[model samples]
Target: MDVEALNALMRSEFSQVANDFIVQSVAPMEAVVRMPVAEEHLRPGGTISGPTMFALADVSMYLVVLAMIGPVTLAVTTNCSIDFMRKPTAGVDLIASARIHKLGRSLAVGDVLIHSEGMDAPVARASLTYAIPPRST
Candidate 1:
């Protein structure tokens, strides 16, 4: 799927928080998702919350899988390991760049680097494994 198709899928399938993210781009084995940081996503320290970034990483990888495999909503995260590296820049959108390390018949593995807009280094990094359900023949 391309950017528009992915964004539309997010809206139709994941409407609860669809407004929070935008699909920026998609290429072979990769995708970029942007989450516009909002007041609700902030913690007491004026920094983006860990859960918020985690969601971004998860969704980013989900989109990458869909971009390559088509709209497989059953493709779900089976494992995730994320490291919070640094404080995210306050009041800026977060960008998640996800690359698929491997894509198999039933699984996809990828990593996401989330950077605060205009920042040099990533604020968080995540490695994820997704289980893609067997397609109906």
Candidate 2:
């Protein structure tokens, strides 16, 4: 697949509507996504919320799927499991490194490791599955 075309598609379809997430960089099989930590993204522990991390994982995997399959607007997440390993710093940016593990006609799977900027270990790990739409051509 054309990586540039896929990136463009992601920007067009998701970037405009994803207020908290940003596509920092994109490659053929990998992508780096960032989410700014905000007060609204915090839970009772005064750290980033689980839902916020889940959103990051979701978007990161979505970008990875798009990178491999081009821009399929109908590509949807069928399953997602995330493990939160640590608390995220409130003011730091959360970065997710997403890589596609399998890409097929009907489905795509990827894993994302999310970390706070400057952190050595990941704060969360997520495995995601997305249903890819059929290609027209």
The candidate that achieves the highest lDDT relative to the unseen native structure: 1
Candidate 2 has an lDDT of 0.83
**Candidate 1: regions farther than 4 A off:** none
Instruction: Mark the regions of model 2 whose C-alpha exceeds 4 Å error after superposition.
Output: 1-17
Count residue pairs with overlapping backbones in model 1: 0
lDDT of 1 by residue, 1-137 (tens): 99999999999998999999899999999999999999999998889999999999999999999999999999999999999999998799999999999999999999999999999999999999999999999
Tell me the lDDT of model 1 at 136. 98
- What lDDT does candidate 1 reach at residue 131? 99
lDDT of 2 by residue, 59-136 (tens): 889877876766677899999999999888887999999998888889888899999999999999999999988888
Reference-based TM-score, model 2: 0.87
lDDT of each: 0.96, 0.83
TM-score of each: 0.98, 0.87
